[model samples]
Target chain A: MTRVFAPLACLAMALFAAAPAVVANAPAEATMGLVQRIFYYHVPSAMLMFVSAVVCGTASAAYLFRRSAAADRLASAAGELVVVFGLIVLATGPLWARKAWGVWWDWDARLTSSLLLWLMFAAYLLVRRYGGPGSEKLAGAMALFGMANVPFVYVSVNYWRTLHPKTSVIMTLEPGMRSAFWFCVSAFALLYALLLALRLRLEERRAEAEALFLALDE
Target chain B: MRVAWAILRKDAAVEMRSREIVYTTVFFAASCVLVFAFALVREGRAMPDAAAAILWIAVAFSGTLGLGRTFERERYTDTLRALMLAPSDRPAVYVGKLLGMLVLLAIVEAALLPLIALFFAAPITASPLWLAALLAAGTLGFASVGTLFAAMLVRARSRDVLLPVLLYPITIPVIIAGVRGTAAILQPVPDEAMARFWAALLVFFDVVFVTLSLWTFEPLMTEQ
Candidate 1:
């Protein structure tokens, strides 16, 4: 597993290196200027956060239905990645918000939802860690709810009427800005894959060790 | 339906004999209201303006306390495992527990309402019937998911700590609707339409969560 992940990790690092260069070279927005560059990191991390949530939720559902150890491992791996990418979003968000909204934090719907979603997944990890014997099933249950909550959280902005940018605004970005955003998104996607693969391998090894211990007991 | 009633009856009998959960939950909620009043006084915010937020926070905290103790009742006798092994459907257990919690929370809220009105200077009786309906729907949603997680965490380490951590995030929508609805109803001039909208949101959440919890209860309860 390390052998496979080592090269992928190296590739992820290379992509991360290239991402900043692309962002720096891309034309800045007229109004926000240099600080607007944070969007490249912010939007992609948010994208990966959603993608990781779906992966975790799907794997959790699979675990519940099939009771497969592999699925549990995959869910656990993605659950951690959800936290990782969520931190990136949370961090980059405020940095951009300070520039754009002139406040470090706004109780805007999208921002609040992202923070809540992050906390929900964080609780999943806590349960898996501290819940003891039945933690896996408990965490799986949490993932299902977390998955179900994604849409409500997204729609809550519309329901409440908030200052956050709408999805349409993201789609309407200028051509150069859009390509730079996608490039950063692609880089983050590769980074997510590498991190998930590494984490899944760790889970697999831990399972094998536990199995071996039980076998020795026998 | 009979199975669920039987379970509810059993819980009721036990509660009548001990009166343990009711007394404690009511007192805790009272203290919560007092704390909110005192804290808000220090901040000099109008207590009536925060009435909705205070009421729901009390319910969330006190409801969590009741859920933990309710399941703790089963844990003491090892009845939870027996219930799991029984031939009857597991969702019945969900229903029974949910109903019992609904009653317990209602009692706590009954005590809480007057205290909130007195301390916060809010007119809770302005639209009593609508407020009651909103509270009912909100409690149903809270208890539906709360009972499921409380049971799931029965033997878990540090469940007392973990229950609120796990519960509040998922149930935010319920609390949000409850607070908003209550706020609208308690206003100087109540907006019937706003109250109805929040009520509908609570109902939708209750239906979705209750149905989902019912389907997932068995698989999660099973050791296999």
Candidate 2:
């Protein structure tokens, strides 16, 4: 019980402690000064969204290979979290896009692929819910396979000219931007770990609840 | 090879006797033809180039109709698993079924080609060689994926609606690439710089996907 809340409490504490340091070290914006903080939250959320999907895919493949009920449950956990965070990223991403690119979307390879990944995983979640009891095996295989689209999206920018800004991974941005970015990265990564751990506990509790009800009925 | 040939022959023979493939394919083709008529009614005469586009669509759609029907034949005969367990490699089953579909598509196209000429007044300048080459390349790509998809959806809840849902988006790129190559070879636009390159792309996509589907089909079918 306490295990679920511990990390989340720690995350809240960490973010509050780090926030002032990030603000003090932040650079003066030339224009639209306050709108830039979105960079911190949005970029890290998007990165963690990718991390969640890769985790889902890896867990799904493990589920397929071992046929373990534990692996299946873990895959489901990753899938549901990916959907929650992927949607958050999608929602906040447009805010960043609007500020940075002056439009909500530009059909940039990353944007298109991210939307596709969200939809595909959303479909997997839907299938898991709606599919009959025996459907897990088939649905799991499908989720694993459909992730091929992720790599395609990642590569599409390089393969073809696109409207989205190419990844600025070179790290030449000024120190203020760099500091905020790293702070946000650590903050969100902690938040993600906390949320995932909590979610997995809830899933286990739900399974226990189901078993209890079934026992009572029996 | 001989066993596959036998299966192909048997399916063809039944198709011939019942006139099933022809009737459905022609009916579907006729309805699509009506769509073309209504769409171009203001023009009053069908353009040859337009005729070519409509021609392939009729083939593709009617081919879907036949695929849905053929995949279930073993189910109706009470022998789907039995057929799979036959003393033949899984690829033989895939190839034989795909060939059956190709034959049906060819028949549908042949019926439509002349009708297209008669209905639209198209001069049919596309030489037989060009048309044959186009059909050969295009059909291989279509049949490979279409057969695998039909197999996938057979166990689904809504097989009919689901087949197209599962198949079309995957096949869209191939269809566009193919029709572009077909159009290029047929029209021979003199100023265009990359006609052959487009055709080459079609060949590449066809080889890649067909090989991919063939390798993947056995695991897909046999997987628990």
Candidate 3:
């Protein structure tokens, strides 16, 4: 784990450095013009946010049923990342909306569901933090519920008409922009992996130190 | 089934003795409506959709209060431990507790319905059966998740504050469906089709969350 950390960090940093150049080279969108550029960062961050949610939920279930410390730590790591990436999606979304939709925000299906999803995971982290002892189990239940809730939230909010672009837009993207989009996605994915690994290692160290202190006291 | 029945009976017997939770929850829900009325009603007329919104808000708020109190009783008596020790299924206990919550909230909503109609002029009785179905499915959805969280928080620190924080976000979909369905019924024309869609969504939500809660109940309630 220690040996691979430096290389992974370097690779992530390199990709992030190259991201701006690729995004700049992509052809500007026709109607929305330059403001559409936010999609490169916003969409990829949103994708990773959902990915982090799935990771957190799966790890939480493993921890609950198997009571594995490793899984619990992994869940904790993924839970925090969900919040981080969700912030990017939520923040950049409005900037683009403000330019394209003539409004800062709308209660459309995609936006509302993403906001609720973010809040649920935020609640997950809150439970784990302030719930005192035995909160891990409680937090695990929260993640599971949060996972099951995504579809319901989406469906209920989607009953009304939506103004946000459908996800199918990715399939029809022009050639240059398509490559740039995937480039940013891979960069974000690499960064997500690097951060998850770093957070997991930190949790492992904390657990080890706590054990050492307990042993010394004994 | 008998285990669940016994637990429900136990909760009912206790509530019947004092009527404490029922009374307080009803009053709390009423006050919530009154507060909203002050803000949304003017010149003796309520804002659009305010009735449906206030009704469900009152339900969610007072329901949280009731859930906390219900588990707090068990924690006070240390009977939760005894109940856990019993040779019965944990999910059955959850169902029993959930049934108790639904009953308490039902009474509150019953009282609230007339109050809302009088105050906001909502046509709550427009489609009686559809309204009832919406209320039932929405309440079940809310209570199903609430009961589990309340029970889990029984031993946690600052649970009173934490209960709403944890419950509201997860239960927002139920609230949305309930408010929307009730709003549809309260509309001048009473859009039964729209109400039916939200009702169906609420039922689906109930099925999913109730199943998930039942599955997680045993592990969550088990102390390490």
- The candidate that wins on lDDT is 3
Question: Which residue runs of candidate 2 sit more than 4 Å off their true CA positions?
Answer: A1-5, A9-108, A130-133, A149-161, A186-218, B1-6, B29-66, B105-143, B175-216
Q: Pick the candidate with the highest DockQ.
A: 3
TM-score of 2: 0.70
Q: What is the lDDT of residue A86 in candidate 1?
A: 97
Worst 10 residues of 3 chain A by lDDT: A153-162
Could you give the candidate ranking by lDDT, starting with the highest? 3, 1, 2
Evaluate every candidate with DockQ and list the scores: 0.73, 0.17, 0.84
Q: Candidates 1 and 3: which is better by DockQ?
A: 3
Best by TM-score: 3
Off by over 4 Å in 1: A1-4, B42-48
Candidate 3 residue spans exceeding 4 A from truth: none
Can you list the residue pairs that collide in candidate 2?
Answer: none
Query: Candidate 2: which docking quality band?
Result: incorrect
Over the stretch B1-224, how does candidate 2's per-residue lDDT look in tens digits? 77668779978887889887678878888788778867864657655366657776777787788889998776678565776889888877877888888888877777787777766655445456555656666667667778876765556555676556445544544465455545554463421223344445545656866675666556556646
Candidate numbers, best TM-score first, in rank order:
3, 1, 2
Task: Report the lDDT of model 2 for residue B38.
Answer: 76
